[model samples]
Target: MGRGAGAEGSWPKTARAALSGAGGRGDGGGWDVTVGGFWCTARPSGAPPLPERGWQLRVSAAPAAGEAVLSAVVRVLAADPCGFRFAAGQECLSVLDSGTDEPGSTGAFITVHPADDAQFQRLAAELDRATAGLPGPVLPADRPYRAGSRVHYRYGAFAPPAEPGDDGEHRPVPRRPGGERGEDARGRSYRTPGRGRLPFGASGAEAVTAAGATAGATAGPGTAAGSGAAAAAARRRRGGALPAGRYAVTAVVRQCAQGGVFLGREASGGAEVVVKQARAHPAAGRAGADARDALRHEAALLARLAGQGVAPRAVELIEQEDSVFLVQERIAGQPLDGWVAARLRRDDGPGVDWAEAGPVAHGLLDLVERVHAQRLVLRGLSPGNVMVRPDGTLRLVGLGLAVETGRPAGPAGTPGYRAPEHGPGRLAPARSRVADPAVDLYALGGLLFLLATGHDPLLPEDLPRARPVPERLGRWLALAARTGGTARRLAPVVLGLRAEQPRQRWGTARVRAALREDSPGRTDATRPGGNPGTASRSDAAGPSAVPPRPRLGGPRRRPAPAPPAVRRSPSDTTGVSGA
Candidate 1:
């Protein structure tokens, strides 16, 4: 059989190897499993209409009797299906966290039943035509085995070849990952001689997946393989707007440099949820590189922190052949900037008054304080990060770039919206250095300034005038805009830490009190308060917490559930009543 992929870095070479000699290769009682037919078409959620029977197969040669054990596991080398569906008797495994370089991998089996003669034949024909003469994925640790009996072939990156009887499907090991898995000279699956081995009669079968293979990444009774982005788009052209409902997709949410956001949604009601993923790992190959990845990070965090205001709630995580996608819950609301200045703006006369923006600015400031108190440093602390719901409620979003003092920080915050530690034009690398909290207070001030003045504090034109501001607002805004030497002096107090150096400028709570009395309506909601119905902060997810389990259970539960783990009550937080 020809190889499919290789390790020493090569592209079409591997793919071609697997598809070399499109049809007619293995004869079970047989020659090696030649590259018979390789049909790999991706449909990433919403662009075209898949032919009613566009999918086809044309592989020849029959396997021997006992060759029943010898099964071919169809894997998704790469896909971008927006709304994919797989047949029954398949396993869909969700691969979360598609890391910087190594995106997520997932897949199931080619449960092509014998009765499906037409579809199978079509699939075979298509595979032969497309993959003909293409090289196979190089199997570094090559092995030769006899027919009739199942032969486990190890290849470049491919492991756990196929299921023993029904033939199992397994994930291929990536070049590198946030973590590592056991491997041999070549990329093949091998169990530690005696570790976790299933008992003799009950052998623990091992199965992994190729990236982006299943619906919702779930493995169960009725599993399906999602198509790639291209195919899904074709389907959309054929069908109209989808009816309304959640859809399992293979597309990703994308943010552009121009700040334009585009997501692929199934035309009908909830047909498919599409998000544009960063093409090349480690970074995106498109515009809005920063915002794009930030959106991804934010989506993943929100997925992990579902229900919490950590980030917008995502519907599904779709790992396509080339990018990482997140299907997020579509929220209906305005950006916070719009709500803050809900009052009419009379741009006609310049000096008249922008006072209507008062409560808006104040509300924004109050929210900023709440954000900091949450013990998170939103690296992307700019106006664009905030959202204003149609109901006149303000929500701080885009936590994708936030720095949670508690968790192992990933690339969470954005540059401008980031804390003072981050530079203005460039974002800080995840490994650059450990970040501190004071920088957040500094950025909070900047964020507040933006709420007050539509421009950024860092911009020279947006700087406060040399003249003194009111004792109340001036003191607060001053601390927010303090830079260099001035920032060093007040930062420590603002951070509530005892340090006094530029790096260690902390702000203790006592010092905050000494600055000035609370600004008017500071405690009240950010919106108008006359209605008496202060919009309650959403019961969004909160900082991760570990509470003592209700002891009705004997010993503590094995293996903690995971963060955003608590049951959220009516309030935004879990267990504790919101003050």
Candidate 2:
């Protein structure tokens, strides 16, 4: 049969009957079975059948044991001899409370989509082998199988291939008697509960209430039907918002081409949460990159960083129609830029208090260092991406652009804060293809400069020219002219981190050491006469103490090369510009 044979109106009666049986409505199709200690549900993709990639197998495991089973399944599939091309979609599975009010256990659902019938059989065989010694019943074909909902992590493509002459427009599916199924904006089919039916595993008073609501809605106008219609209209007005029952969106935090960030409250406990949504195929800079993949990558990274307290805690990932939602604990804080701007507005001096910014700078360094230690680089670190909590600690947000070390450095991160080596500047021609932590260091320098002087280091003209400074600070004096007394002392250290060349940039270790030198209780021991409290006669003269400067680009004598066994110390105390 041709690929388009499975189009909506063209589906054969046999196929429709088979799909109806697989819907898990007790039509004598099949029942859930145990495989390797996990509940397995095998069903049709509900997509128009292509020559290949038409079957889905869902595996459910107890919350405590989900990770282990998921890993085992991945390993087994990776080593499959049949070269089964498949992907796993992950989600949290919850069973509603029964009449007895007994607590139910939460679990994970792994939905696997196989390329074809041959691969599907191979996958089943391999799974059996992987869980051979485990204590569970073997897979059987007699029971009804149902599909899953609210997918969180998608490892590979599960949608059918686009057919020739396809317009990518959504076409509604024919609804069944008790439930509804339809295509989303992106032409992906999804099933949702109808008025009379509750979700799978729902029972007791919940089911009764749902049935009662349905009955009332059908009783005609001037009754409950009028109110039901109003409710349905409200839902349609919500449009692409999250599913209604789980979360109630209160406000929108940010909206971009990629998606929107929403402030919501959980229905279960009324706890505030942040919901970040990613549209199916938003515009992107890199070819083949989409918002879906970025959101999925971020969720995986958040899962890895859980318990570290540096990033927001991931609540759950929900796949609702064409958009994906990532729910996280609401962080109670303001953006770093807003906080700095507020402090600057209140300060009588041109610059902020160094005592306040000093600790913030150290906190940023520590957070970035910990991220790098895990072999990840935060390519999007900027004043906007960092948050200052109520307790005066820092947390890194906007981690969607982060890439692992040694991977190709794509066009990611905010413009001014991005490193020259990673951007499309003259230096990019010779830039390394793989990403590294140096990019983050460059942004760190810019952030610190802003914190100290209330100006961006990238734009030298923004630096204040009225504030007088000692000439000994070198090339950085112009940049630090407006900084506070204590902040001026760290100007060289900040400039060193913002060097144009990656090789010329200061590493985290050197930057930390410089901050320690100017830390509280530390004395300037490098001054002449070993005096910690007094300046030399030359320093007392201020700007006049500086000697006439040599012109740039003039012929200059080169220093002799150092001996092979001897190392030369840096002329600049910051160790960033001396070489």
Candidate 3:
């Protein structure tokens, strides 16, 4: 929490996957790749090869009862730096990392078209061959790596074991156990390969082999050397069951508004997982959010990370191809919100529940600290984004929006603590329209306020959910309101950070001081009742309202209003890709 921390550095020189984020990558030049279960990198005609732009390859298949994590690869091209794009799904699903998701980087996904499955097999074979001899990436279980660091496969260009080790073992990769580096798990845009300064100490090629980053993994034989259409077919049909590894997944778990979440398992093997089709809900996509796609992305991410987090690898995603299927590790425990809700239901005043719940809170905060120390920011932090199990161990799920640097960010916060800045471009407006550590804290504080107060801070009218703090918890709630729009006068610091003028937000140090504030040894309850007649929190006396975030995917016909510019680097680290 002090000056010992590393200074925030400049953006990566190339389009590397540094902590910046995933959307609107560096001067992408408007080129796009359609229909992906795989992404490939290529250079323009007669070029030296893309220096930073990277290509991705993953193989996934959903399951009957649970999903599997399979082998995936990230290939950086030295050829023309082209961009490949796709969407995770229409709606926002739960991301393990909460708010710190990389914007344009799609989660790992594998969707093999039935007709093309055959071709994918051969292509998979070739890739396996290529990667089999290549050096594996240098990353340990706990050691973090840059976003695009290549993980060698034993096929095609990514093959392994060009020279067998004297012991005949694919070199053993170093494992960091519980140590975390480079923005805690899923938060930062790590562009440096997992080679440098290790929290566990291993480094370089030794780190790669020491950690088993690419040892033992092999691709199949008899593959398509190359024939464009045939190659594409093979790539599309590579969707297969996820391979067993450090991670496991639930059969696609189904959550219905009517019946709650029902775990669907395979009828035969307990180890097998399954996914059920959506019941034609407007939100569910036909070809869009299909199960295969969901499982594909989940599996892809797991394989790419080698089962680093809670999301499981994909086994098989689509049955009907029209429905969306999601396969994941089937994490034990309830949603953090649900966990808190049950505790609150007991209604015992700050006694056993708090004592019992301490670990969960600590674990969540611990993760936040580690992530932020790595300079990773999960802008979107909410009870809904956290999970707590019976054992009290917590894993922050969701990484779709995590980013390394904070930019064009403001408050776009959840209800109660929804600061004035969260809307479109409220904070330093020049860069990306995303959240950072301060924003993450604002949300975390809001969640904490709810826990302490036993009321959802955001009333039905104030937010999307039913989280208003209980009257008894008013004093703590007031402290969390430091984000200007929501705080009471006693905790004026929160207001300073949340001040209408973006300039008032200042540096990360300034933001942190205001957000990490303490209660004044206790105070009066300002909790509102019916007709409490408080002015709407939105009536911030600083800057009026800024425009909302750009429409996620509306037609480009009309331009939206941009927010006021306090001015900072718009996440300068767009896809400064690194091959």
Candidate 4:
């Protein structure tokens, strides 16, 4: 094994030594080259040393599965920190390129920069252990991309050379049909999955689309959409379910509800957009049409709620070929659960006490109130649906299950946060079909408790043990739970809002008034000379009479910490249940 015959240049002394396997250690500050299969060159010191701030991880996937692979990897990385943790941020990782657009290219490239090198190392080592015994084919040396690139070792190019066969001859190189080279029997470019890059003249997008089609054809019965029967039915109805032209589907994000969510790039502007299509259940007849109609109703509701900041703005609506596509601008923020977890991890101070929960609680309450005022009920409010923007403001999303007030609908909300009256048990023969504002209020209280205590109020058994806070707010909270004095105020309001029966729950006005009262440095609104309570009662009123409340504590001079990044689950992209 030696360097390629074409390696005739002023190679760096260290690199040359490494290629020859001359006394180079793993930790040595020089390049290391592995021969055979596909060449792997490591030049740890060839480029300027990156700062210790973040560790870079390069990922390369075969063109056929590139987009899916990259998406799966991002989901894995963005998941909550369990065995190995990776930070969630816009800078954490990037998709360098999907070989689909390039000629002869058959791979996707991505670079992951973990905020902590040690964590990256642990993750890499764990992955290495997990895939220990998987057998794989050798990669070809002529692949377009080389090991020297950031996507090093992502392909099978890093595999060790094969030993001589028993016949004392190396295995013969596989050939394409017609005895031609660099292509398969199907006339498609030939390359092992995750092998460096595409051939000299392959269309990456075509390969990926073909792969997606193949996958759709073979998708199992339980997935959100796409199967032999569905595709055949779709073909019978039209060439494809979606309308032709306008938006180009880039990748299938995931199946949501009974539908599929696709990532799309607008043809005119090349801007990224999300296309949420109606569910394509295999069941024929009115049931399927009903499902499609439900999605349309959702889209119409979303269009009406656009610009309210409670949901992502609907960009356009396309209804053709018996399919409905709701295109919306992608929301740029972290999930509420992820954000809260990140905040809890970063905060050195005590958990969100009464004062700290004031602003956040009020923000959510006001947002929900706004939606109710618009005559809509967010039937699916949950930590998963809320997104925390970088500016620390919260945006409510996942409006797929939203309905007009008083509308009778199936159970559609996250279970833990659902009001007792809306659960399956209460949906029996005897019940009102009307949706209640108090339902949203119940969810709001649950969210506030989560932010304050980092635990779901309903699931009290698993609550984190109480830690001391700077103020005696914990004691005040406990006292408020029993009897209300001056200090014991927030608990009563929160409890009242979350009461099991909707009739006993506090209204939006009372919740806001309580929040204003609990906020530190503000005189009690019920006291003399305090700002009139009427101002805080209605969000539509001019400027809020209550001063801006500080999070975590009373006002401080320093800018508040930026909200933590949200870790998104695979289903998050589509709000699968609603899509």
Candidate 2: tens digits of C-alpha lDDT, residues 295-326? 88898888877877678888898776445778
- The parts of candidate 3 lying over 4 Å away from their true place are 1-269, 272-326, 345-347, 350-353, 373-376, 403-414, 417-419, 424-428, 431-435, 459-579
Candidate 4, residues 128-212, lDDT tens digits: the string is 3332322111111112122112132222211123346888987433332344423211111222343323322335544333433
- Clash number by candidate, in order: 118, 5, 130, 7
Best by TM-score: 2
C-alpha RMSD by candidate, in order: 22.3, 18.4, 22.8, 20.1
Model 2: pairs clashing at backbone N, Cα or C within 3 Å: 30-143, 30-144, 31-143, 31-144, 53-115
- Predict model 4's lDDT versus the native: 0.45
Candidate 4 least-lDDT 10 residues: 87-96
Which candidate do you rate higher for TM-score, 1 or 2?
2
lDDT of 1 by residue, 485-555 (tens): 22222222222221112233223332343233333222111113322121222111111111112232345
Which regions of candidate 2 deviate over 4 angstroms? 1-233, 236-241, 345-348, 425-427, 460-483, 518-579
Candidate 2 vs candidate 4: which has greater lDDT? 2
Residue 103 local lDDT, model 3: 28
Candidate 3 lDDT score at position 73? 22
lDDT of 3: 0.32
Ranked candidates (TM-score, high to low): 2, 4, 1, 3
Question: TM-scores, in order shown?
Answer: 0.36, 0.49, 0.34, 0.47
Candidates in order have lDDT scores of: 0.31, 0.48, 0.32, 0.45
In model 2, the Cα lDDT at residue 13 comes to: 28
